[model samples]
Target chain A: MSSYIALFGNPNTGKTSLFNNLTGSYEYVGNWSGVTVEKKVGILRQHGVPIVDLPGIYSLQPLSRDEGVATDFLLTEPCSAIVNIVDASQLRRNLHLTVQLLEFGKPLIVALNMVDVAEKRGVKVDAEKLSRCIGAPVVPVIARTGKGTKELVRAILSLSEQSGEREHVAIDYGQDVEAAVQKISEQLPDDLLASKRWLALQFLEGNERIHAYLQTYMDIAPLVAVRDEAQQALGRPLAEHIYDARDKWIVHAIETSTVIFQQKPLTLTEKIDAVVTNKYLGLPIFLTFMYIMFMLTFDWLGSPLADLLDQFFSGPLTEWLSKLLTLVGASPFIQALVLDGIVSGVGGVLVFVPQIFILFFFISLLEDSGYMARVAMVMDRFMEAIGLNGKAFIPMIIGFGCNVPGVMAARTIEQPKERLLTILLLPFMSCSARLPVYALFAGTFFAKNQAIVVFSLYVLGIVVALGLAKLFSSTLLKNESSIFVIELPPYRMPQALTLWRSTWDKGKGFVRKAGTFIFGGSVAIWLLTYVGPKGIGVSMDDSFLAVIGGVLAPILAPLGFGTWQAGASLITGFLAKEVVVSTMNIIYHAKDMDLLQGAITQHFTPLSALSFMVFVLLYIPCLATVATIRKEAGSRKWTLISIGCALTIAYTISFLIYEGGKLFGY
Target chain B: MVLTDLRQGQKAVITNLAITNEVVKQRLLHMGMHEGEKVCVKCVMPFGGPVMVEVDGQYICLRRKEAACIGVR
Candidate 1:
């Protein structure tokens, strides 16, 4: 069995970067907080010991779901030693968590990261003196460059070899707090003997999570009484009293060891923020950033790569397979299944890969450069109408490119309620996948003003998403007590290597999902179209796909596009939104877009065409999006709600559009 | 004075948090914001957006509703 080391720290303190350094692994690192939302394990190569990198948190008291992950690991997990990463530039605030870790009574080694940044800002720390003050070995490190990592690794191996138990640090608070600590310590159970002092301190500070954990082992009536009495004794909050005592001890340590040259604080960050967050310039700046990212991802870089991929699959790969089948004397049925069903089915899903990676690269850049926090702050005012803060806005914007990445990007939101709300509302963002359907319909129905029609659909998606968010946040998801607060980290230029690694990390999920879920969904749709009860390779009108479409067509009658051909196209659309157009092309026996558009004009009027597009816009999300939602949401319940909500809203809205058009004599 | 009442470049020492919710109070405390922490308003966004404040060399954004609960002077 291998011994394990627990890596912990305050959020955005370079904990993940240090973990990446020690373990020789590349996990995502972001400037803003809450980027690592789950615990990850990597091996220390030299020693082969497991290092568990827990989510970054300020203290044992969790403010959000990710913070709870760190706090739970601290209380429950057993480790040989604890590696606490403290940001050197923000020493005072980082030390607040370090103080709590000291009282945790584990063998501790503090990795003082970002020393170079601290030095440039005129802040210096004497590692040995600070170590003596905190009763731990402090290794000054720069995680970004792997500087001092060798010594840090050596210190970690030595720290783990030492005895795991140590005397917990007991700071002498004012008389009132100390009195209450003594009484609460007496009331703790025997099982919590070693941690009684720390538990009592946390209990007095109103850490409800710790209080509830203690409740299972002992009756907490007396502990509660002590806390109330202590709060009454101190005219101010008891936590402040405790903090003040720790600050006094820290001040002495800082005065003795640390030196400050009194340079202006964060001049670069302050200057950049002044203009980026200006009253008039903030929003326009953010919008410009978003537009640049979209253009790069969709037009400048990603589009050419995707087009090349499309040509390879349809032009070369399909022809090569056909030649091979002909030379081998294979049956025509086998040729159709191989070329049309498998080749085209899989290729269609693969075409989106470039866009996903390019979009993820830009997202990683935003998160790493520390501009994400500012984006949230700038958008919070507009998002307030939906009862959400600005963090929820990031995922929705990303959804405009692809919903799979959009759903995965919701992890940055700290609170679970906001994250879930963002995920549920993602389908209505009018992703690039739905654009083909809009192009086919809008080109035929509203040829004179194609841009306006497409833009109107995009605006409708946003308006409905916002309206539903406002409804759900106040009703079903109203339980969270979260406050709107954002921590603005200093902007740093993202390194090329880090940007690539994180982009790969995020983009890989979308690819894997496409490979498994989308692949299977395409095969299933193809199978239904290829065979019917009448016989194998029967016409699609008499096939099982058509039967299913007929079942759905009646329900869609009120929405004005009630034919089985419309229904069949929608059934295949579930596999991927792009498949709907292809399915219509095949079922309607139209070999090209002009033929399809000519045929569609004969089957429906302009009003029905618009309603059909609306139905496609708000119907259930594609299968890959559903699968990603299930994995990210972590519950079967929310995934169903997302699907059901989309289906219901799509139906109601499309029906209104079609019927109201008739009532107004359109 | 409440925190939101401070203009740009105005500094204030946090006095008492007039919040009834204990969890929100704990969050504020854990951010190194307590009774005596000095904070300077870096910028106040228009249309009642979040106000960016610099405290102890750290910048944080606090919305108007939560900022108003911070008793400062």
Candidate 2:
């Protein structure tokens, strides 16, 4: 029989890294999951057994959706054995879960992960002593280096056969609570999964799960009434007092066994965090960092690469295609459809791959370097200022790269209301995918002030996000103050392997999304224009798409953008942000240099082009983002509200930019 | 002192958690805020709102109403 072991731990404890080391596979690693807050399990093939990595969580208790999955799997399924991964440096905090698992009475192997980190921090742990205390086989392993992991697995296999009856090591609570636990245990069924003592303690503490369990399983009203009376007589809620007493006992145990010197010299991470997370300077530093990031995205790196790509695809590729068509004797309609619709549409959008890579690369570097945590800290105060919870800032920061991942990051926030609010506002943060459309217009029309134009749009995204967050928090979601307590992992020089892996992962996602959605959309746009009515062969300026664009033009005329080119991009942007640039390519016959140059000068004024860029910047996210929002929010109402609000905001901002610029005689 | 009575920036050593539930107890332990840990009040929401307290160099914010239920000394 093959054995299956599930590895579990808290966030930022190197759980994923450990799994990757053990499995030799690159699973997505983040401070939080990118989808419905559930454990993403990836199986590792061992010699004869399989290892599953569970999501990192603080406890088996279901505080969030991820935790719930971990809790459910452990209780319901009978795994051959379990490995509890612990951050050796943070053992005191990590041990709490170890104690909880002890109650389960399953065969557990302790993987003392990051032992090197603990040693570096001058914290020495006696794994032998710890194992004896917890009645488990403890292996002091440095998971990053794969040290002691094989031994740890061997220990788990050895213990798998000895699981029937183990000594129950009861935690010391005070007499009254212990007495209440004893009374409650007598009333519970023998076959119940949890410890009778624990369940009784839960009942005394007025635990919601226990109450529901009791109500459903047994006619325990009388017993609960008696327990309540006993709790009242004790002059306290039974649960609170017991937990407090247990805490004191655990502290004593740790103090007796675990030696700690708190007065250690400040580490290098602290030196950096002190300056960056400074109460006075943090906000300014955060803004400066963000400004630099936006500037670099457009000016420093993105511009040169984008220009080169544009030249290659637009200048050379288009000219070559036109010459080829002339030789092949292809009809004008077919040539236009093939060159303008397919090549210009899809190929044009793809030319901005440089900008997408730049954005995701920087984000990946920040995340790997641990600067993202500091960003979260700086933004927490500002988020609180806007009446948003601190936990909600992470998803919004993530939204700067991509709304799909941003919406998925909402799982960590815990509170349903706050999670929904974060999802609704995520699309408003300028995603990197939106950069191509901005690059096209700003590169063409606002070349003199490209950086400023790009920077202003990013600022606009923030303003719109904050506004939407405020609106949602105030009306749709009540003022629920969800607490934020995030762990600050010590900063290290980001591992080069990790950074490269992350950057490549994000870049690959961009390429994949382009290939799947943008490629298909581009081909569809090509067919539409190529096969349209009359011998005119779907002139982009007079095609069915243009007619629809014209119909929507008047409503947006005040925004100084009634052009079919701008209107058509907005329509395709609803499919995917990448498609916006491609859609413009199709309409403008961008692959044909003469047609591309002529179409831009004849059809679009600089102000209308600016309006168009602003519109794309603030417009609705791709359909995937909408579907994710609907799934995560668990209601169509919030999703619909998000879409409606995004469109309205996009229109309003474009209107201001276009009309305001024209009024100022730009 | 119970958490409800602790003022902002005041330090209190948790003598008792006062919540008897095993899950809650496990969570408090997991958070490193179990008994004997010294916690300093960081910020209290306006109008006796959710209280933010720092324990073991980490801050945890909870509603004042929930704090009132926890027994701390």
Candidate 3:
């Protein structure tokens, strides 16, 4: 029988960091709210008990999909204890959830995280006093540096050791509301998961989940009547009355245990925000940061390392591996499988790992430094004008790294219509996987302006995504977009370990995909290219891959890369975007990357190559992304809409580019 | 007046939330925007963007339209 303890907190309270410290597992920790969309489970190292990290939530009554997940988990999962983490600096606001958590009556330990940050602002929290007042052990811990983590773990172990019947603190809603709650509670089944009083409060507040639960066990009309009676007596929505009660309770708790010195002057975060989020300077500063990030990724760091790796893979690695295979008496077919299929296919994708890592590194830095939230704040108006909210920008930026998580990140957007629209347009943000295609083409065709060419493609993706978002909002998913109420957390230096872990987590996914999807895809493509309808070892032109590519070539003819090789690479790209580069690597038989670049220049004029890159940028997202769209959107209709819209947009844009170039006679 | 009427650096107490949408109301309440809580207008983004408000020691950025629904004095 394994006991479970859940780490719960408000957003950006360092719940994930504390979970990481206790469980020794690195889950993605961001400085903004809603970073952890799903709950993650890991075993505590000291107690060997499984600890779950729930998504950050404000209250038991969920306002968003991610918050609903946290609430749902607490309702369904049986846990021995809950380690409720709260930001000490925002103790009053954070305690709103803590007060609600106390209603569940589980063995609870309150980890007051970020105490040092609070102290810096001239706020002092008496932990022992807070512990006594809240009736839970309050441990001051800095989750980022792992300070007080051992004490936290010890508290949890001791909490589980005690009999789970702890004193539950209940807020006293006024007499009328209390009477209504008591009336509703008397009707609830004894075997219910949470306290009857909690359920009654939820019922009176018109919680949909609680209402539906009442419908199953008993006739909900009586409960509804009592709730209405209570509302009529209280002269307000039950939720409002309940909120007032909890607010008073939280204010009392804060006044008892916390002291504030004289108001501090504008802190570092405010000073930074004064400029970074200035109305006139905000967008420019954001754009400048983006430019710097891309410059660093492409020109300064990533591209050079990628080129070095490309040379190593094409020259020394291939030579040594081929020689070793020949010495082992491996047949020529086996040699091709090892050196060409596995090595070239996976290696071609791996060559871009440096660029991907650097891109993720900057993204993590932005997210962990708390700048990502401000980006959302600055971009909100622009996004709202285009029929979305500012928060949608966060996912779009994430889409630059990959569309799968970008689409999933839309869960943070409370509006269903806006979220769906965000998911549909996410593929237009040319992800890092598509970088290899751009790098290969831009480096070859537009060598003098490779950086500019790549930058233009990214800009093009955003423009198209926005255009389509506007179109969708006006037509298909039209609705009043939800209000934007995002928190701007104080800026802090990103912890090195957390930053490295996030970068590695994203980079590791790329490597794993390269190993499995790209490796298998490369072999399948190799077989198709090698074996003709007649037999094996046929000329490349007569191979089955050529036959298929020839069939698909006409569809792509207007985009200017209608050749069989382009068609085949685009087809393989469905597995993953990077496979397009690997497929081209295998088909052109350019073992030397320099020769490959030369071969590409000979085949594609700069204009046609640009058209092709644009096509790849807007075309159907990889299969994983499409599947994620289906899951996230929860409708085949919307998934097909996404795929259809992407394909149509890609073709239309590429066609215009290709024909428009021909008119210019470049 | 609604929260949007507040000038930069103006301080007021939230008098009421005029939002009709339940989700929006819940979200605001969860962020500690209950009536009687003190709110300070931190900054207003140009071009009618969000109004940044400091409440309960947290800086929250709300769109102008959303802010328009927040009654304050």
lDDT of each: 0.80, 0.70, 0.87
lDDT of 2 by residue, A65-124 (tens): 556667666645557667888877777667766766765556677888877777666666
In angstroms, give how far residue A218 of model 1 lies from its true place.
Answer: 1.9
Name the runs in model 2 displaced over 4 angstroms: A1-4, A30-36, A46-52, A75-78, A153-223, A226-237, A240-266, A314-342, A592-598, B1-30, B38-73
Query: Across residues A1-666, which tens digit of lDDT does each residue of candidate 3 receive?
Result: 455798889988999989999999988889899898888899999678999998888887777778778888867788888899999888888998898788777888999998888888878899999998888999999998999999888888888889557876778888998898788888888887787887888777667866766687887888888988888888877777787788788888889999998567448888898899987999999999999888878788878999999999988999999999989999999998877677868887899899899999999999999999999999988888889989999999888888988887888888888888889889999898999999889888887788888999999999999999998889877757556779888898887877898999989999999988888998999899999999999989999999999998998888888889999999889888999998888887777568778777776888889999998898898999999999989999999988898899899999999999999897
* TM-score for each of the candidates: 0.87, 0.85, 0.97
Q: What is the TM-score of chain A alone in each candidate?
A: 0.86, 0.88, 0.97
Best by lDDT: 3
Residue A142 of model 3 has an lDDT of 95
A10-119 in candidate 1: lDDT tens per residue? 88889899999999998878888777778999999777889999888888788676777777776676667889999888788788788887887778889999999999
The two-chain DockQ for each candidate, comma-separated, is 0.73, 0.21, 0.75
User: Which is the better candidate, 2 or 3, if ranked by DockQ?
Assistant: 3
Candidate order (DockQ): 3, 1, 2
Interface RMSD of 2: 5.4
